[model samples]
Target chain A: MKVKAFLLGVLALAGVFVGFDLQNSHGTSFAAKKAANYDESVTLPMAKYPETGKHIKDAIAAGHSAVCTIDRGGAADRRKESLKGYPTKPGYDRDEFPMAMCKEGGKGADIRYITPADNRGAGSYIGNHVENYPDGTKVLISVK
Target chain B: MNKLLISYSQLIITNTDEEHSSFQWSDEDVKRGYSVQRGAVAIEAINNDESEIEVIVGSYLPSEKATVTYSLPFPVRADSIIVTSPGAVTLPFSVPKGTYQLHVEAIPLQQPTDDGLFPVRYQLYFDTNGSK
Candidate 1:
């Protein structure tokens, strides 16, 4: 009778352990950049260009569709906040691609328009800088 | 040659009959500690066929003394604000529910030589309280 009681107790303990593991089991939870519940409603930083500025007017008028109007109001709110650190080795700058421009043939069409980090030292922007939106942000580029 | 300016912003508004009930946005209003001013041009769209929309841009100095305004032609809007200083400027303003054009302007305004511009980037809030 004692042996049977011991066996039942062991089974019950095993079942509890299994249940706990099941509750925590979700696929690929080890990934570094998964969006959290807090990341749901985020405001992205966006830059706007005015036609009055010389280079901007020239760029937009030159048919370079990548250049568009800037909304400084959007940029002001997004100035220099901590970003989710990506997996990176020390001393190496983070590899990033600006969210593709919508005007022309999607992305990969024009390389000249892209401002490289090497030429413009990482974040040293000479003129108006548009904070690149992270992947998966709903974007709206329009003409009014 | 272009100049670098910081600590300022270009207020873009889509005004109707009253001119106050419109959506306005800028970058210089928020980048605090760094000088925020007009920088480079982003884009320009012109309507040769007919008068479409008008864009008006002006520089808003945060303080009471230094006056600055770079108003654009009617209908030509701004998309970006150039950072005149090495850092950032922040502005906070509200927009009414309406379709509008946008742009930014920035110019680096400080060297080791000049006095630093405004402090603290402007935080955007609806004009329900009134302008500061």
Candidate 2:
């Protein structure tokens, strides 16, 4: 209605997107800031860090797609399951494709040995970014 | 400060010594573009942004300057040219069979755009002309 529009205009004038409360399927209200800034999907730059990049490609090719799923919780459990059989090496870290945080990850995920610099750095870069996104999100796994 | 880069692709190049020989990978010659009627396999790899790339000739350990580097121990037969990037540009070059290291330098040469894809430029260090 025109009245609602006027109220929104007044709120926006006072502060950007203020008082913009919207309900979701769960019946919880979301702040206007979050409502306006939701990332539908994320892209994991496989080639951004080529060492970890190659491992991701090879792991997917080896049959692990959950690597594309974002983890909502239980990352420690997933890591334990996916890395159970792969022992750590002196110069290498056991890298899992469907990383621990991904919903599709854990237990039976493809594991590869890669350098720590590659494994840790790329993981943190993406982990830091996606931590802002909610759990159970599907991310686009891409190379180059 | 650390530099910002977009992509780091692991490229594979295959080379068959001859018609009836097993493939032994490594080194080669050429600078740009791909030849349809070619002797070596036309190879491709992924890069995120169309920033600038640095192609070096010779078999050396990976360089620290490169944003990302990998080894392609497959056979390569580039007696002519190569196609790189997101099909933006082509260059001519050549390499044969042997384990070789490839370095990808993805420094932004221009301002990035909204949608993320962009054009690319390159710099070549040394020549692998008749390089093995």
* Chain A alone, TM-score per model: 0.20, 0.63
Tens digits of per-residue lDDT for model 1, B14-75: 22222121112222312221222232221211100111122223333233321222222222
Tell me the native contact fraction for each prediction: 0.01, 0.00
* Model 2 complex DockQ against the native: 0.01
Residue-wise C-alpha lDDT for candidate 2, range A82-109, written one tens digit per residue: 6665554554555667766666777888
Index of the highest-TM-score prediction = 2
Model 1: lDDT to the true structure: 0.26
* DockQ scores of the candidates: 0.05, 0.01
**Residues A1-144, model 1: lDDT tens digits:** 999999999999998887566555743332211323111121212232222222323433555443223333333222211112222232222211221212222232222222222212222332123333332333222222
Q: What share of the true interface contacts does candidate 1 keep?
A: 0.01
